[model samples]
Target: MKRVINFWSLLGFISVSAFLATEIAVVAAAVVWGISSLFGLAMVPTIALGILVGVPSLYGMVKATILAFQAETDPENN
Candidate 1:
């Protein structure tokens, strides 16, 4: 019922967040290393690399979250 659905949703959210975090971390690390090798400054390169890798994921997450909120709020859903 409701409790079961809520549990599954919570689990799904946790798993998805963990997966995304891991993906972002790996991509950010790789990008930072690559950029640092090319440019020789670890800090700025890492920040830039993180931003480059993280932005698209962030955008997609925001879009999906907004869509989910919209669906939840839709009168037809009620």
Candidate 2:
């Protein structure tokens, strides 16, 4: 039998994943900024570093979440 993935399930999964990614990025940015401030690091470099770290993780999470819902080509292969 072929595996099936419904639209709503995929949508809900992606939406929740995006929300989680956003929350993580925001928290990471705040923590990095705070730590940089404590150490007297410059604002521009701190923000840049935060974006460098957060954006890739966010992209990776979203990609992984979407891939998780993909239907298998051969259900029995699993």
Candidate 3:
């Protein structure tokens, strides 16, 4: 049978993804900034580095969140 994803479920998944992605990006940015700061790097470079790190982290977090949601909502396993 073809699986049909409900609208509400998709919306909830998106909301959850946003929350997780935000947290992941924040943590990643903090870590990158902290490391750069420890090395006595300039504030501007540190902030730039944090942004670079945060973007990839957000992508990874979103992908992971999608996988988790898919696992939970897998109709076959129900």
Candidate 4:
């Protein structure tokens, strides 16, 4: 027996996964900013902190998701 991965399927899966992750991050950042506002944190510092934390976290998550998807789709896995 043999297995095959469809290129388009992988691409679409990765793209959609990344997109959903970005959307979640955006919402989370907004919530963090809003909470900081309630605590009277300076807007500039809050925005900077959000960018510093959010970017790398999002990147890591997306990278991990892609790797996992690839592993699952690998024909040799079977």
- Candidates' TM-scores? 0.49, 0.56, 0.65, 0.54
lDDT (Cα, tens digit) per residue for candidate 2, span 1-78: 655545655565667676766776777778787888888878788878777777877777777565555522224424
Of models 1 and 3, which has the larger TM-score?
A: 3
What CA RMSD would you report for each candidate?
5.6, 4.3, 2.8, 3.8
Error of 3 at 25 (Å): 0.4
Query: Which candidate number maximizes lDDT?
Result: 3
What's the TM for model 1?
0.49
Model-by-model lDDT, in order? 0.62, 0.67, 0.76, 0.72
In candidate 3, position 28 carries an lDDT of: 92
Model 1 stretches astray by more than 4 angstroms: 1-5, 42-78
Clashes of 1: 0
User: Residue by residue across 1-78, what tens digits does model 4's lDDT show?
Assistant: 343567765776677677767776877678777878888878787887788777877786778677657665767763
Q: Residue 32 lDDT in model 2?
A: 81
lDDT of 1 by residue, 1-78 (tens): 122235445555556656656675677668767777788877776787777777876776666555554544444544
Off by over 4 Å in 3: 43-48, 55-59, 76-78
TM-score, cand. 4 vs. native: 0.54
| Tens-place lDDT digits, model 3, residues 1-78 | 544377766676677777877788778978896789789888798888877887788789978797857854567744
TM-score order, best first, reads 3, 2, 4, 1
Clashes of each: 0, 0, 0, 0
